[model samples]
Target: MAGLPSTARVVIIGGGVVGTSSLYHLCKAGWTDCLLLEKNELTSGSTWHAAGNVPTFSSSWSLMNMQRYSTELYRGLAEAVDYPMNYHVTGSLRLAHTKERMQEFQRARGMGRYQGMDIDVVGLEEIKRRYPFIETHDLKGALYDPSDGDIDPAQLTQALAKG
Candidate 1:
């Protein structure tokens, strides 16, 4: 913490993933005069227990785009930073046991299509093919998004902070 600046163009509150990410992006965009303040330790809040699921499938086009952007950003940041984010693009599957859930998935898939996301509603056989361990007997279908995955939120936040 030596040579701390007396003034910063941007003072971001919190040291969580979002706050650090904002600081990181601002720096990347050529704004080096920024400061991030955390009342407690970084990622000690909700980010610590987050599922870390970076699913791009959403009923809203805007949300889907934002998730997609975040996923891409995390992927690039993991490679660029010395610290590791443990990002895993293992994809995601949302199971639908009931007809109502199936319809919801279908609608979400439709929304994803407009957002340029490759999401699909797959039958039980396809689900079983992808995830053999899943118990697909009771499932009507599933929504599969190939780009969806996860990352270590704490590690990502650390990397962002380092940047």
Candidate 2:
């Protein structure tokens, strides 16, 4: 800690995903006099246990937009920083077991379409085709979001800190 700066325009409290991301964004916006302090190593807290899923399927328009933004950001973050985030572009599926559930998925698909998302209400056959190991007999269909994916939480934190 001897070489640490004594003054900063902004001080972030932790080194987890949110904190590191905040610091990174601040620097990106030309706020370079920012410092981040952590009690332990980066991602030593709840961020270590996070699933790090980037899902874009949402019923709310605002939430869907946010999710979409997050997905897009994560997709390009690793390349921007020249760090490997282990981000996977594997799509997601919300299984619909009954007609009511299928109806709900249809509504969500329509909403996604309006937002220019690549979402579809796929039948059981399509689900099985995409994922052969899944048991789809009881499922009427699924709400599929091709943009949904996941990332390594620790790697993401490191990348943000590097930025």
Candidate 3:
């Protein structure tokens, strides 16, 4: 930091994980002079309420790519930044209520397949047996992505800062 200039060429707004991520990436990309402005404490904004569920079953390619990047970045954060980002891989279980919803999930799974994502359309029996905490009666089915899961924001922030 002492070798870099005092003023940064690029400025990032916000202080949440995303903003911190942008700052971290900028530094990693050789833009050490980049700056991030946070009006409040880190995770003071919408990020504090975030569920930290990183998924990869989006229909859009760009969004999916971003998810991919975030997922990978968080997964290898320990090696990349010398600190661990507490990411949970509990997987996501999206239950269905109607036939239409089942169709929608099928379409989503198809789209995920197109994007090379690991997604599957499961039946009510399967979901019920797996989770056992859900109400499947009168429902159609569900879409389960075993790789989807949550993350700890505080540890993630610390990890990024540690880098």
Best by lDDT: 2
Q: What is residue 12's positional error in candidate 1, in angstroms?
A: 1.2
Residue 100 CA error for candidate 1 (Å)?
3.1
Clashing pairs in 2: none
Off by over 4 Å in 3: 1-7
- For candidate 3, write residues 65-87 as lDDT tens digits: 68867777788897777876668
- Please state the error at residue 91 of candidate 3 in Å: 1.0
The best candidate by TM-score is 2
Query: What lDDT tens digits, residue by residue, belong to model 1 across residues 4-112?
Result: 7889899998888899989998988999788888879999888888888888877677888899788778778866887877888888889899999999899988888
Lowest lDDT sum, 10 consecutive residues, model 2, at: 66-75
The TM-score values for the models, in the order shown, are 0.82, 0.84, 0.81
Q: Which residue runs does candidate 1 get wrong by more than 4 Å? A: 1-7, 133-137
Q: Which of 1 and 3 is the better model by TM-score?
A: 1
Rank list by TM-score = 2, 1, 3
The lDDT, on a scale of 0 to 1, for candidate 3 is 0.79
Tens-place lDDT digits, model 2, residues 116-153: 88899998789999999999878899998999888899
How many clashes (backbone N, Cα, C below 3 Å) per candidate?
0, 0, 0
Query: What is candidate 2's CA lDDT for residue 155?
Result: 96
